[model samples]
Target: MIRGVGSYLPEKVLTNAELAKLVDTSDEWIQQRVGIKERHIAAEGEFTSDLAVAAARKAMAAAGVTADDIDLIIVATTTPDYTFPSAATLVQMKLGMHHGMAFDLQAVCSGFVYAVATADSYLKNGLAKRALVIGAETFSRLLDWTDRGTCVLFGDGAGAVVMDMANDEELAAGRGLLSSALRSDGHHWEKLYVDGGPSTTGKTGFVRMQGAEVFRHAVGKITDVVYSALEQANYTVADLDWFVPHQANKRIIDGAGAKLGLPPEKVVTTVDLHANTSAASVPLALSVAVADGRIKPGDLVMIEAMGGGFTWGASLIRW
Candidate 1:
């Protein structure tokens, strides 16, 4: 069960109008194309770990627990501060924890969903008593500012949740993660990916995407997992109280929702304010909806995401 959720966006905001000066684009063009109006950007010294720690603190507070209560930490991120220490370790240290295990999971935008599924497994197996799962990204550093297609589509932010074992009463009431379905097709990985890595160019390369190709695949892949997870939990589109999909593009999100037969009112959208935060998208939207009181206890919430590596997944949770 998820005890609490929280999210944090950087203070600096980059509006579409401001981006016009940097590239041959305008507010209307960006909105009409990607449905993004503004995005948060991290300052010069604000790293991904910093964003993760901040979000973690909020989630911990909301859960009414401290570092001593968490025995496991999992950060799902692509823009880690370094290749060695892992962002999870940095967060664990900042939270003053020395008795727990922490690590990172990379599934790009599908990260948070993957992290949640992973944490659920650990808890169910009794390997961990409580887990802090986070999805954080500094994608602004991965974009080619010159490429209007990618640069204006990402922002910096982090979102987290505190999950623990549910009591027998809560379990009987179905108040926890019900089921999840995850998938990846390496053949389509090139459609949306960064060109560099430690084993390759020795540099963090810019985001390179085949927009049309990705759009063609996104809807189908998204719906596949959505339906799979829903069915596994004995649920249907009508059973969901909230449908929170990845905040990559409005078109993809809409396409998936429509395919799932979900109404516009039931879907949560925050891309216009935060753009695409990759791994942070799902949990970010979850936090927003929770903070706004849109998602309440006993609500059937389904979260889904499709990311680079052509990775995609969905989780049906009972709130």
Candidate 2:
């Protein structure tokens, strides 16, 4: 069961108007295309681990648990503080946790859902009793500031959830994760990816994307995975109380929602405020909905994301 959730955005704010000064783009164009108003950028020296720690602390507190209670830590990110040690370990250290397994999962924006599935498996198999699942990103560091196309679409933030093993009775009562569907197609990797990597260029690369191609694929893929997950849970679109999708673009979100026949009020979006936080988008939106009382116990929720690497996934949860 998911015990608690939390999210953190950096203090720095980058508005589209401000971005226009750096590249040949304006607020109007960005809004019309991506539906982003402003995004948060990490300050100098701020790392993905730092954001993860802040969000993790709040999640732990909300769950009424402590660092010692966590038996597993999983961080999903495309931007880690280093190529080694993993951001998960750094987050564990910062939280003063020393036990349990800790690692990182990289599936771009679909990372959080992937991590959730992995953690859910561990808990179900009794490998872990409690787990910390976090999606943290410093994507601003990977953007080509001069390329308004990608730079204006990303931001820095983190979001986390505290989950623990739930009994069969709890599952039957719809109190935990129900099902998940994950898919990846490397053939479409070039459609959206980084220009460089440690193994490829020995340097952290800039974000590169074929925006039109991505949009063309996103709606269909997202809709398919969402329905797959719902079917696994023996539920349908009418059963969903909320649809919290990756805050990548308003157009994609709206398109996917329309395809699923979900009403506008059923969708939860935060892209206008935080833009796209990559792996952090899903949990960040989940945290916001829960905090605002839009999500409540026993409510059925669907979470999904599609990002670089052509990775995409969806999960069904009964809050």
Candidate 3:
């Protein structure tokens, strides 16, 4: 069974009022359109690995496991501390975990679902016993503060889950992940992307995006992916107990829910509170919903995300 989830947010809070000083946008404009009021920002000394370690410790504690129990670690993010070492390896070292396969997965906002699905496959195939799946991002490192379009649309945070293997027979009796679906289209990569990179400019660059274009594809693709996940699970839209989607934009979340025949009340939204944490958004939303008791074990949960790589996907889990 995938046992527990936990999250960590940085100490510094970036309010819309403060953002106004950096860009031409107003607090009212941000709230009315994107629903973001404030977001967490990593301190100068903090890095993505720090957030991942904190979240991973919490998840391990909640699951009643230790670092020794984890056989695999998957860190998902678009923001890494460096280009050489994988973020997951950094996290493994921080956790003092020495005996496991560790790597990173980059699927932009859908990274958590991708990591989770990969962990599920590991457990289901008996290749690993316990897996640590983390979605950590320090998006402040990627933004162009001068650009109002993308600057106000992101935050920094991390979320994690600990999954343990379960026998098929036991799973059939309700002890394992039920279903998951993931998809991506590289053709839409330019819709949103960084302006420079290591090979291109010999230095990291800021993010650039077509906000309206992304907004158009986001709602439709999110709804379609959610429906596909449900269909694959042999379930219908009505069967979902909670729709935990990427905390990108308020309009996208609401629009996708409505398009999926789901009521606003059935969706879990944290965009107003957290903005888009890239790969961290979905798990962060899931962590919040579970903490609020809006989601629980034995309930049907659907997670979906759309992001910069123009990558998008969804996962259905019978908790």
lDDT of 3 at 95: 87
Q: Summarize candidate 3's per-residue lDDT along 156-271 as a digit string, tens digits.
A: 99999998876676577663666776777878888888888889998778888888889989888898888888787788999888899999899888889888999888999999
lDDT of 2 by residue, 42-150 (tens): 9999999999999999899999999999999999999999999899999989988778999999999999999999999999899999999999999999999999889
- In the order shown, the candidates' Cα RMSDs to the true structure are 0.6, 0.8, 1.2
For model 1, state the Cα shift of residue 221 in Å. 0.7
Task: Score candidate 2 by TM-score against the native.
Answer: 0.99
**Alpha carbon lDDT of each predicted model:** 0.95, 0.95, 0.88
Please give the range of 10 consecutive residues that has the lowest summed lDDT in model 3: 169-178
Clashes of each: 0, 0, 1
Residue 236 displacement in candidate 3 (angstroms): 0.4
Model 3 TM-score? 0.97
Cα deviation at 206, candidate 1, in Å, is: 0.7
- For model 1, the superposed segments whose C-alpha errors exceed 4 Å read none
Q: Which regions in candidate 3 have their CA more than 4 angstroms from the true location?
A: 167-170
